[model samples]
Target chain A: MSIDTSTAARVAKLARIKVEDDALPGLAEDFNRILGFIEELNEVDVEGVEPMVSVEPMRLKRRVDGVTDGNQQDKILSNAPDAREGFFAVPKVVE
Target chain B: MSDLTKLTIAEARDALRKGETTSAALTEACLAAIEGAGALNAFVHHTPEIARAQAQAADARIKAGDAPALCGIPLGIKDLFCTKGVPSQAASRILEGFKPEYESTVSSQLFERGAVMLGKLNMDEFAMGSSNETSVYGNAVNPWKRGNDEAELTPGGSSGGSAAAVAADLCLGATGTDTGGSIRQPAAFTGITGIKPTYGRCSRWGIVAFASSLDQAGPMTKDVRDAAIMLEAMCGHDPKDSTSADLPVPDFEAMLTGDIRGKTIGIPREYRMEGMPEEIETLWAEGRKMLEDAGAKIVDISLPHTKYALPTYYVIAPAEASSNLARYDGVRYGHRATLAQGDGITEMYEKTRAEGFGNEVKRRVMIGTYVLSAGFYDAYYNRARKVRTLIKRDFEEVFAQGVDAILTPATPSSAFPLGMEMDDPVQMYLNDVFTVTVNLAGLPGIAVPTGTDKHGLPMGLQLIGRPWEEGDLLNTAYALEQAAGFVSKPAKWW
Candidate 1:
């Protein structure tokens, strides 16, 4: 129920947020505090209760699986930090 | 001409239709006010050119006799909304300079109805914090001071800037999305009216996702009627958001009859927390009496899981946030970290996020990531969802018993001075205690300014209504507004 420095580091990595070595303890403490607060949920008797996926009682609406809109690769890449040749350019993933 | 910015949406609409005022004049007045109120930091982006053009278009629409309800009204948009070409940062550094290519569905709907946008307002970064202090633009100073004291008070958060803007008359109203009391808490803090409609009442198409299930968009306005008017224009079923209900958006403005005679109002016993401010308690009692005076049958009720709403919110919101924010990886839009010689994509995401997110955001993302992790998923995320169901059932039970609305103190206390609880996140989280249950249950809730604390700061009373019953909720609040007759505006310090 409590997160230690190593756990915090693991979580930060999983979240893709960089928490340096020195900051992990502090991050752990923050995590512990939040988790401690959230531990109150364990008191509830949730036997046979369905985890709510939607607030309203409605089945997810379905639409015909077709391309409703597209054909604007330029617009899609407009805000990219690096877009080249009509594609999003990232640091070389395949070396 | 003197104070067109101060006019409520209804008044502005009436004046415009009577040919007594033009949208251009209203826009100019609001723009001038916004320019002058720089001290409040309510408006982070000033769009006078866009406002003028929209106002001009609105004038043409009005002249053509095709004006909608929001025609010619100027309003401030929360930074969370992806306003096309406007800097919609959600008050975060990560999104610095990111002008969204597409408009958020709610905002586009408003614009389509001829609502003019003054600019983007400040908020907690990604709508994460209870105090506006977490905003990258610095805290939006509360226009209301502590009874003529010089120290600045917080306008409450996530929707703090929206509240402050409406309170200071910088804009007639502003859009606010409440994940956990972001709208109602700030609205209470700033003595304005805010309503978070039922979860699916408004589409979430272009809103920067916070807690997907919990985040519902609503209007923060000067009064109950204005809140009603703006909420109507802001809501519709959008096919783009599958969660959006196909149910019709009722004429919320027309439903404000202010006659709640024979309406059953519940006073939830669970909301009366220990250590609650005497002022808030008295305010709640006064609210009960006022509703009673309006012929509402007041009954005591119990929502047993009320105490757990905040805990559930913290878990679910951040868990969803961690996932939603994953899209901000370096490859796409938003701030990308400057890399060192040997760095790769992982390094880029880490550094970008580490530098980009504020401390509160980082903490939340960490918590969210932790809860959804392998070992803890069932213990945390799944458990919170079940508690959420219980919390929701509490409301359903009350409503099934013919309880039309539930009234409680909007906040634990009036707006506190800025920086009072910055060190303690738990203390700050308590601000949403009264408001979060509505979000957990996906019910319509509104905060109506009802009274003032001893320090003369405004205090509000909240009314929780049935699901998709914003019109009824607004009407109940309208009755409270009539009874309380709270007309005190914060003395303009900024």
Candidate 2:
């Protein structure tokens, strides 16, 4: 499917990445080209073929729900751009 | 000592064992070489203090007679793997100044085996680009120039820096991750050896996520045996990464017997694409002949779905990338955009990603988001998944027919000029044509430098092995490496 500037703008919004109006056209063009290339897969007849969920055929390992490791609050917050009072700080959401 | 930095891992291991050379001397030699080779820009971070400390510890271990195979060997790590307290940016602005509090499993495994870290290597931003040009630290230049043209060429990506570091002898070996030809392509371009083992072979925990299913850490080294040595150390089961296989990793180096008598090697006719460079074609033929002379039977085969592999990879990788990258939203770590007076969290995330990611990464995120969007999910994402199954099936059919391995050219051409294919993204994507199918099929593949093009740039041939049979694949490559006798170096252009 061809993606236009408006659709590209919508996708940018969905992706939470800001794209200016002028850049939308270029972004749309890139999307169109990539999608155009990907469109080649349409020729393949996938009738009765199963989608590959995993490359290897192994059962997913499960464990009893339990906390394996934690409590290093200082280390976890060391790299935060903004940390306050043992928590990651963000723009206030509640009034 | 005649340049201790030039010794291979095997040679260095022997010397260390025999008390002929110390790890401290080897580490100092590598650090000095890295200091002088700034022109290539392969290393993005230098860890001399860490290297020296690790070397001292390794020397002590050797004295106690408790050394591992990689004891005291210096190696470069691609910026993609997170090393504790080191800047691990994945060659993107998004992760600027982001040092991890913990180490990636692969890096930690290497360290535990007594490997020394020389520094972090550069790569395409988020491992998204085929050439190293998209790296934030700038292109990692290929040490091999085309017959003294003096124009900088690319060490292929997204493991370009790893390839460059190993090829230039700046380090004995380096770690590389492949999603779709990242390791093998760069290895081919730089005239080194790289292998991408079967999916689930290496633990994915602590590595910056790319395409999760396709991404795997491997070794880029001066030769096939080094590749085997480093790969064995790099692979193991991690409870943290559920996808990591529980089976034991074999002694890959010990399996390099270089004997392929009565083995069957498949030459996929489908890989003989239109407009393939005559040099690459000749190299493939020579590889087949070498295998035959080593007492193997060569047969023409067809992987009909080969052409669709790239397109399928593009779809699936991006879709996964979009989901994987969602976590980098100006959160606990990494670059966060400055906000205005009334800016909310939404605005913060939008601005942060837009300013943080490079053009290629942005384009990929956009394409990935679009394909997985509501109206197109089935048409794009699901369709690609089905196509992926067929691609995998094609390899299974061939292997099931008793084909032990497949031989093909590693890349379509030798290293091109730095900015050659920037204008067309599709053209850049075409570089992985011969190598991506192996990733899609979840099989081990290695690129061994076998010959050179007319311009004196090294070209390589790839060997595709059966599932979970990296030992056999490496052995076949060992045989080819012995027969080809490719001893040419890049002539110290840097």
Candidate 3:
């Protein structure tokens, strides 16, 4: 499962990180080294092993569907890189 | 009064109770130490005013005859844990200029118990690298060095700064987070004790996310007792973090009987890897012999899945990291990129992330995205999760066989000089080979500095415990510490 440069470029886009054409080879090399080692899992016999998703035997804690707390918009927006009218501002999405 | 900075957290607490010392004086000593150890680059942010205010408050609390165990103790908080109004970047450029309005639950609990914060410590950026070289604040030099070799060595990371600060006596103890041996490796390299409790032992709320399931906060301290004391305060069930355990916090410090009588310590044969440094193997053998002398029975064990731990961890951690890091787009609290005319929101995200994340972080994200992609999900991510189950089962089966704990070398070798392994990222990943299995199993693990190598650089042995049994784990580590009698410290170089 060697990850080629084109595939590495695609993954960079999927992860929303920009990679220059020159850097793709380096990224591909990393992916190859990691994936090459990880491919050893093929030799592992995991026929009936249930995936241990969480270490604890926990069902996600649920809460009653209600607005228990709100109105801390100022505190929430304080760290925003760009905030306007108590909402996070972003580049124009619509033309 | 300068000697007060050398006392362990437990000793310092007792001294404060006896009126032999005051929190303000200790804080001042630590501040002076930090100011002098400038070459170490251990501290990334210095909050002298906050530290002084906290120390004063701690003294008043003690005078009022109501001081907690940690009252008046000055400690460094790793950059991964958010302290209210303190600059914490997790040693990454992506989070430049970001300060949380709220505090992480672990640090907040430590504060409520009277611990004084000196500053935020440096670490591998986003907890991604093995060495401290990836830090945005530059590399943190290990206080310990090969004798007569002046080359700057790394305090093994991503808790490198925390380990270095505690080893250098810049603070009493420091808060550290371990995703993949971050706490233990650095602690070993710096000749201190560090513990990474069961995964759910500490709350994750307000801490910057790395690998959600594997990340845990712990204490890196001068000795086993301080690690125990600080851990007791650092861990509590928090409703704020859904994955936080709902178990009652125990008195870890009190449970340290320093007796391993009638205990069964397992030495896994798989850990005796081929071509391992002879010193690490020798130290491990010594650790087993010491436990045997302490009236404990030693048994041979096999964790067959040990060979696959690194691969399994690489897949699962990055997959989770990709999902967790998606929130770091330009609109969020972290750094945002400048926009060009006609640039859409997508450009903002791509450019911001491109300019913000370091090469190591970007590589991890890319690997994560590729594994979780639609075409390779089963082949990589899902398969890794299943393999993870097998790894956990290996530990469970061993523990179920009346094996009280498993012992192994903490790191492959002692601290190496900076720039030694930076060119090969795979070589760096191998540093966690002995430590990552514990995280994959969600078990508690401790790294206790046993002795120094022939080069006079310290090495440690890890003790892995069954899930949620940190008390027993700490007791075993205490017994080993007592038997090893590791009293060597790095000479002052800064």
Per-residue CA lDDT of candidate 3, range B57-173, in tens? 999999999999999999999999999988889898888888898899999999999999999999998898888888889999999989989999999999999999999999999
Clashes found in each candidate (C-alpha, N, C closer than 3 A):
0, 0, 0
TM-score of 3: 0.99
Q: What tens-digit string does per-residue lDDT give for candidate 2 at B243-361? A: 99999999999999999998999999999999998888889999999999999999999899999999999999999999999988888899999999999889999999999999998
Each candidate's TM vs. the true structure?
A: 0.99, 0.99, 0.99
Docking class of 1: high
Model 2 residue B60 CA deviation (Å) reads 0.5
Question: What are the root-mean-square deviations of the candidates from the true structure over C-alphas?
Answer: 1.0, 0.8, 1.0
Worst 10 residues of 1 chain B by lDDT: B485-494
Weakest ten-residue segment in model 2 chain A by summed lDDT? A86-95
TM-score of chain B of 3: 0.99
For the candidates in turn, chain A alone yields TM-scores of 0.93, 0.93, 0.88
DockQ comparison, 1 vs 2, better candidate: 2
Off by over 4 Å in 1: none
